[model samples]
Target: MTTLAPASAKPTPSAPTAPTLEWVNKLVSFDTTSRNSNRPMIQAMADELAARGLSPVVLPNPEGTKANLFATIPARDGSVTGGIMLAGHTDVVPVDGQDWASEPFSPEIREGKLYGRGTTDMKAFSGAVLGVLPEFLSRPLLEPLHLAWTYDEEVGCHGAVALVRELDAWGIRPRLCFVGEPTSMRAVSAHKSSQLYRVTVSGLAAHSSMTPAGVNAIEYAARSIAFIRSLADDYRISGPFDESFVVPYTTANVGVVSGGAAVNTVAEKCEFEFEFRTIPCDDPKSFISRIEDQIAILRAEMQLENAAADICMTPLGAVPGLSPQGTRAALELAQALTGNDAEETVVYATEAGIFQRAGIDAVVCGPGSMEQGHTANEYIELTQIAACEEFLHNLAVHLSTTERNEQR
Candidate 1:
């Protein structure tokens, strides 16, 4: 009689046996949400780079709670200039309201998918880079291979903006930068720009029963938002369109709004956060000018009721778009490595735009999809990880054999 092993003794089909999954698990274990401190996670990655005989630089934020990481695997000739960069953001979006089948921070494998926050919205890409980094180090490289990871991308590209400034100061610029932002291993040469702002409307608070006695801040704010919607509708029906994007025209939305102390009182203050995502060719200033023009009209009307009434606008974040005209080298390289010849443009904004504006050629080519990102039970398919690994190894081989571009 054959002795049968129990079900519990059976091997887990979804266990993290793959090299890329191992790194993914290690990274996804940390909760580096946009609002939380990313120091611990950055330190762990820094330690890994040090262990491999690399001098990884960690630049901390003003509060020192968050950080950005930059490291390089120099070429055989010990040159650290004019090479390729593999980059990704460190922070994940908030999982506050989402109901997850698995714990967001504790990565789990099921059905050949690794489920966790940042798994698709880009820890997997970061993991893939780290997993293949040692291989790049072992090989004799013709040009340096650099790694860049930033904090607070989910909030905005603040970390990347600061990092690029620091890189500028150091005069450490890469010839091409591959920003890993979940394109399912395809290359995205261009992406839309993002501009977010906050508005605060102040008014006199009084009992709801007294109509017009107190300036209704919420009422005036509604008018401003209505104008913003009208602007969005105009864009939707207008001629200034780029058919390449999934959402061809520019988009405007009011994401967050908070006001009104109670149902029985007139709101004394109303605050709202709004954003505009424009195509690379679109002039964001025109959009802003129109919105401001409408807001000014409302502000004047609000003050008509009470001269003390006011509206204040502040810039929250700005991420410039990646224009296709400047990324010839990066496009050619990503195409060579992935064999993906499609002309791709993503509707989502990325740090690639920031890097591109900073005089570095950038392209988005990474594992997984945005469909799985920022949602409950977020997961990245095992196949995507394997393909990304293959791409990275191939990139290493190509870099090892190719000569550095002197034009950069």
Candidate 2:
């Protein structure tokens, strides 16, 4: 009879494997949700970079609760200028209401897909860059390879603004930037701009029975929202359409509204949040100006009813769109590396636009699909990871070739 191992005896636990997968697993285990601090993840990445003979720079938010990381693998001569940048955000959207088969933060692989909150949204691409770090360091290259990881990208690209400013001041601009934002590794040349704002309406509170005595804030707010919808309708029927985008034209929506204390009382204050996804030809500030015109009329009307009545509008965020005309170099490089002949555009917003505004040409190319991002049981296919690895390898080879040519 063949001897069998005891039931409780387990094969020596397999040593941690899949450096890329390991990085993804470790990153996913952290709940770096948009509202949560991402310092831990940044620290972990900084430690890994340091171990690889890199001096990672950390730019912390004023609160010191969040951070952005920038590290580089210099050229053979140790010069760190005019290189390619791989950029991704560390923050993932919240999983509060979404149902999931596995913990969103506890990564699980099934059917050749890794299920996790950030796996598809971005962390996979970040993992791939870090996974191929050794290969990048091993090669003698003519240009540096910079890695940029930011925080709070899901929250209107707030962190990237400061990070970009810092990079500009540091004078280490990259020749091109690849923003890894779930395009299934295809090169995306353009995307719409996102402009979010909130308006607060103020009125005098009183019992609902005395309707004439108090300014009804909610009623006024409803009117403003209707006007915004009308503007959206106008865009839908307008001629400034770009057929490349699914929406084609600019769009607006009132996403949130809060007012009224109770059924019997007139609301003293009302607050509403609205956004405009504008096309490249449209100026977001123009939207703001139009809204302000409407608000002025509302304010004038309210003042007639009650001199104390008022309204205030504040800009929450405004991220510019990446125009294809200025992104030719980035497009060509991404196409060459991925062997793709076609380019595409997206309706969604990304930090790529912000980077472009900072004078760095940017293209969106990464693993997984945006359709899978921010959804229940978010996942990325294993094959996508493999393809991403191949892309990184090709990038290394390309840089190596450039180095060789210069040396000759």
Candidate 3:
């Protein structure tokens, strides 16, 4: 969780840069797991961008432990107003319990597969962007091109929330954005919304021998967990579904849990983390409203057992679903770039929706696959990287060829 802040003094600008493959390996070496601070990685990238004569802005969390980076490559006319923004989160999921074929943070390659914790999930996309920086710079762009590398995306897209605010503050609006989120080099036009939460329960503790003397927090927590499962089952049987999604309906899952001291002791507290991935047609507010009602009832039930007992649910973060309404141009551009005509959608969430919420058309298009992301021995086929590079190349060509006044 340790992070170093960006150096206060700016360095002299330089044009020398590394290749995309080297950038991918270097970025993967940084362990930016959700629980850790990504300030070091953000600062390093900022320095590189700044040295290349591009002004990159570093936006940090309230605590200043982590940060997001935004930079722009203007058109031949030196205008930074309307253009395309390429974004990717710098964070990777933890590799704690998974057994990797090679060191998780140390990048390795075997038989055309790059092995690393974030090789497939995100760093590859970000690395490929860095790799193609010069290509974007060399072209006579009609509109500006932007890079938005963010933090805490593995958690709840929190850093992107901040990035949106920062963009508004700077009065910068890109024509659209491409959120590179391991989509197998395809154009993804829609995805469900993702919301995360944590719940905690407290009760009076006593010896296990005298169950009547203690309010069992763990037992109370189980009641709420069961309630969550029941809601999931209810939606599974209901019809407010979007067939475009793989799950085709809303879903809830409790991913982590912990509590208690020992088997011989009555548990005084219990904590659990859960999330709701709601289809675009569903309302997450209604879902959270139901959860809050259940929390109030559970608190009352616990209080009846012991005056000191308590139960509470805290919202972690949320992102809205991406729909096709505003993505016409972005999808077309993606299709033109990748030469994929099929309309694709995913159940997983991405930062694309966050950008769309800011009135920017956004789509999910990137290298790698969800099958490889967040798994042991995570790797992206070298061919996927090649495809992404070609996609970027085509994008640069499109921007370079667009008329300055047309404003795509």
TM agreement with the true structure for every prediction: 0.93, 0.94, 0.92
- What does candidate 1 score on TM? 0.93
Weakest 10 consecutive residues of candidate 1 by summed lDDT: 1-10
Model 3 clash pairs are none
Candidates sorted by TM-score, best first = 2, 1, 3
Error of 1 at 355 (Å): 0.3
Candidate 3: tens digits of C-alpha lDDT, residues 1-408:
211111113231221134878999889999999899898889889998998899998988999889999999987999988788999999999998998778999998888788999998998888888888888888888779999999888888999999999899989988889999999878899999999999999988999999899988899889989999999999999848888888899999999999998898899999999999898878899998998999999888888888889999988989889988863778877877787766799988999989998999999999999999999999998778877877787788778764323424
Estimate every model's Cα lDDT from 0 to 1.
0.87, 0.87, 0.86
Candidate 1: which pairs clash?
none
- Sequence-dependent TM-score of model 2: 0.94
> Which 10-residue window of candidate 3 scores lowest in summed lDDT?
1-10
Candidate 1 structure quality by residue, lDDT tens digits, 1-408: 111111122222333236667889999999999999999989999999999999999999999989999998998999988788999999999999999998999999888888999999999988888887778988998788989999989888999999999989988899899998999888898899999999899998989999678988898888888989999999999937999999999999999999989989999999899999999889899999998888888889888989999997889999999889963888777876776676699999999999998889999999899999999999999878877877787788777654434344
Candidate 2 per-residue C-alpha lDDT over 19-123 given as tens digits, one digit per residue, 9 for 90 to 100:
888898889888999899999999999999999999999999999999999998998888898888999999999999899999999999998899999999999
